[model samples]
Target: MSKQYRILGVIISLAIGLAILPIKLTSEDLHSGNLFLAARTIRYTFTAGILAFLLHLYLNRTIFAARWIMVEYILRIIVIALIICLTSIVVDAIFNKFVKESSFTIAKEDLNWYLVILRCLLVSTVQFFVVFYLQLVEESQRRRLEIEKLNRSQLEANLSNLKEQMNPHFLFNTLNTLSAITNDVKVKDYVSEIANVYRYMLIHNKLNLVLLESELSFINSYLYIIKTRFGNSLNINIRIDESILPTKIPPLSLQLLLENAIKHNVASLDSPLAIDVYNDSENIIVSNSLLPKKTNYHSTGVGLNNLLNRYQLLFKQDIIIEQNTAVFSVKLPIIKS
Candidate 1:
């Protein structure tokens, strides 16, 4: 048995033993009889207490089916009753042999041993049910917690897979943009910048979170490629607090938001699409003026969905999205270290 159970057994036994003392001392037989008979009564009460504790400990370790519960309890009651009766008889025999002048007896006429046996059975039955009920409740709670943990683990795995899929799509789009550049010199420089962007993606994609500063540096490399392609048509502004540099965010989160703005909106010499990145007390805000393309561009919104799922897994905070006829905005929470 565990140490905790051992300690509990000792405590319960002592409590019952002490509670019987005053009643035994006030009995006419015990008060009038010599000190020897009084001592024996106390010993018997303590022995019954110990026996009740043992029965409780034994029943806790044994398992019974629902159909067999009553049968098992009846069996326990019979066994404890027999043990208490045998103990009383043995102690009486020993006392009688030592003190022949005043022979102590637990005989039916003298001491009513049946009542003592009945009390032992009752206490044992009550203690067994109390412990059984507590164990049932504890096991049920343990199972519930395990199920919740399993569900959370499965969700995290799905979000990680979604984030990893973005890498290939991003590489494909960057390569497609590079293919259209006509200037050989400009193409060579853009190729170097694209290489740096890919290197960052490969190194950090496996991680759940990255420092905001590191992600911003990667965004700068990505913006270089975008600025080369769109020229004066795209205008991106950034205003972030240096104190929040140590904060963490999912990798490529900002890049995905900026890409979404450029994908759906019109950005040309006549109508420049301006995107702004800034931070508030709790979140990093990405906003842009809405000027949707005249021609329909098939869009799936996979990137934004992937970001939302990733944030849900990493933190409890929600990613806020707001839109109107004139502008669109998304707020990403900054995870503190």
Candidate 2:
């Protein structure tokens, strides 16, 4: 605990002690008169306040670790009541032994144990609520911090993905392809498709989720660029249900998967790279044949990892990956808008 909170506790204890002084003085008779009564009231108030403060401190730590709310609260209340009862008995005994004609003696046969227990129970109940409210405030603050941290991390990831997409290598490769295509008509079309791909990236990269139809349309433009570069060596098949078109997904998810397939696998006239995109009942499935290249592709695994993080942050869902000697596949959960 900070010095500030400790000071607050002291102030609160003193305030509570002052508040109960009148009740204690009025309820008991002091043979020595008002001075003795006042002294006893001060002692009683101080004891109660200290007990309450100590109970709060102990519970502040224990309550967070406790499971089963009802059981924990019941146990805490019983413990608090017992502590208060024992402390009151001790205080009363001290006063009876030293103070002349102190009426608040627990040793007396007429001393009402029922009222003592009732008072202890009432105080414990109030203490329990105070601790409960503090716990709620602590929990709310913790949640707010977690949300802020998550948002910061998510923004960084989005920026990294955008940088990856706009890298000079990708732009250079597309320009290189355009330069080699001698036909003016086809060159114009390819340039248009490349523009569309980058335009989509610029527009939707910052968003958490985009409509499935919009993503599909973006992927078509992305594929057009890829197909222009690879020609007959690459083949992509897409089969999606129109009903799921209105669903939402992380932008560029399909494009990332497709890029991963192309980057890591062999694509040629002899051995064409085959990729399939379709919708299962609950997921959008992306599967490609596992044809490894002789020269291993340098990959940092950032794209798929970023996609995983985005999926978890957005929907609390995991993208399923299935792989074997012949095929590699991923199942992205279709989140409803």
Top candidate by lDDT: 2
Which residue pairs clash in candidate 2?
none
**Once superposed on the true structure, which residue ranges of model 1 sit more than 4 Å away at CA?**
1-188
RMSD of each: 15.7, 8.0
lDDT (10s digit) by residue, model 2, range 1-337: 4455556665666566565434433334544477765665555556666586668667757544436767877778878877877887787777777866545433343257886666666666666665566567666876687577668756876777666676646775776677567668778777878777877887787777799999999999888889988999998999999999999998889988999999999999899999999998999999999998888557888778878877876687999999999999999998976
- Model 2 poorest ten-residue lDDT run: 101-110
Candidate 1 residue lDDT tens string, 13-57: 656655542333334455446665555554566566676667666
Q: Estimated TM-score per prediction?
A: 0.50, 0.61
Q: How many backbone clashes does candidate 2 have?
A: 0
lDDT of each: 0.74, 0.76
